[model samples]
Target: MQSWLDMLREARAQGRRFARVRVVTLPLNDYSRFGVWCSQFTNGAGEDIRYLERGKAAALALPDHDYWLFDSRKLVRMHFDDRDAFLGGEVIEDAAEIVKHNYWRDAAWHHAIRRDDLATEQHLGRV
Candidate 1:
């Protein structure tokens, strides 16, 4: 068992500031466009990507349905296999679970999202 957020907090405590973090919705291509009318971003999601939407304090709390998290310190690089677990809300405490589960597939234009900084672009929409 691991917590991506906890690992990040600990790293921060040791004077490490996260430069960037990323949350890719992953391609839900299995479903047809009409199959999904619209999907809500995890939390703090501006548009296409969701960052560390909350501060250390708020993240520790996880708030409501926006509890999904990723830890840059713990995990890096996005791949294709990491789709289900990330969106499924499993191991959400540690966003790095994406890496653990190999859920990201590095496609073109992928980026990393961090709480302090965000990749600006409004992304909440229907397929």
Candidate 2:
């Protein structure tokens, strides 16, 4: 975890922005709670983390899976199993796919609430 935080810090130092919009359900599951805990450290390290309720996210009709968009160009789509266990990621370099991912990122980022604000709103103190 320290290494990840260091990487975020280094990226910020290099003037690179790292951000994520996590779509979560009303009653957060164990995994989602864990992610919220981790976000505290990541946000402190300069990564911008936001939260969007699942119902709100549904209106946007974003992808069912998670992805990482690099520089609004390259994309790494994450895959999961039936039980939601991690599988792997597939890198996509197709321009059209990249554009779609960028659009989703922008839309989610625009509607999501910042980590701190969400924590306060949800009464999730330190967890």
Candidate 3:
């Protein structure tokens, strides 16, 4: 976690932006709550994290899985098991695929609420 925070800080120093939209469920499972707690540290380190309730995200028809879009150039599709354990990631450099991920990123970012704002509004940080 320290390494991740350091990376985020370094990226910010280099004027690079790091952002993510976390889709969370209504009931807030233990894992989701833990993620919310962890986001505070990451957010402080310069990552722009946002939260979107599952229902709202469903309307956007975002991918059922997770991914990382870097600089609107490369896409890393994340794979997980049925139990939600991380398996691995597939790096995709195809222009068309990257473009699609970029569009998803934009749509999610537009509808998601900033981490701090959502925490305050939903009293999530208290969890």
Q: Give the best candidate by lDDT.
A: 2
1-127 in candidate 1: lDDT tens per residue?
1354456556766875443223333342334222222222212222233243224324344222323224422333222343434433333335455543333322111333432233223332533
For residues 1-127, write the lDDT of model 3, one tens digit per residue: 9999999999899999999999989777888778888899998999988988888889989887899988889899999999989999999988898998899889999999887777777677544
Q: Order the candidates by TM-score, highest first.
A: 2, 3, 1
For each candidate in turn, give its C-alpha RMSD to the true structure in angstroms. Answer: 13.9, 1.2, 1.5
Tell me, by TM-score, which candidate is best: 2
Per-model TM against the reference: 0.23, 0.94, 0.91
Q: How many backbone clashes does candidate 3 have?
A: 0
Off by over 4 Å in 1: 21-127
Where does candidate 3 have its weakest 10-residue lDDT segment?
118-127
Point out the worst 10-residue segment of candidate 2 by lDDT: 118-127
Task: Give per-candidate clash totals.
Answer: 18, 0, 0
Candidate 1's displacement at residue 116, Å, is 8.8
Off by over 4 Å in 3: none
Clashing pairs in 2: none
- Candidate 2 regions exceeding 4 Å error are none
TM-score of 3: 0.91
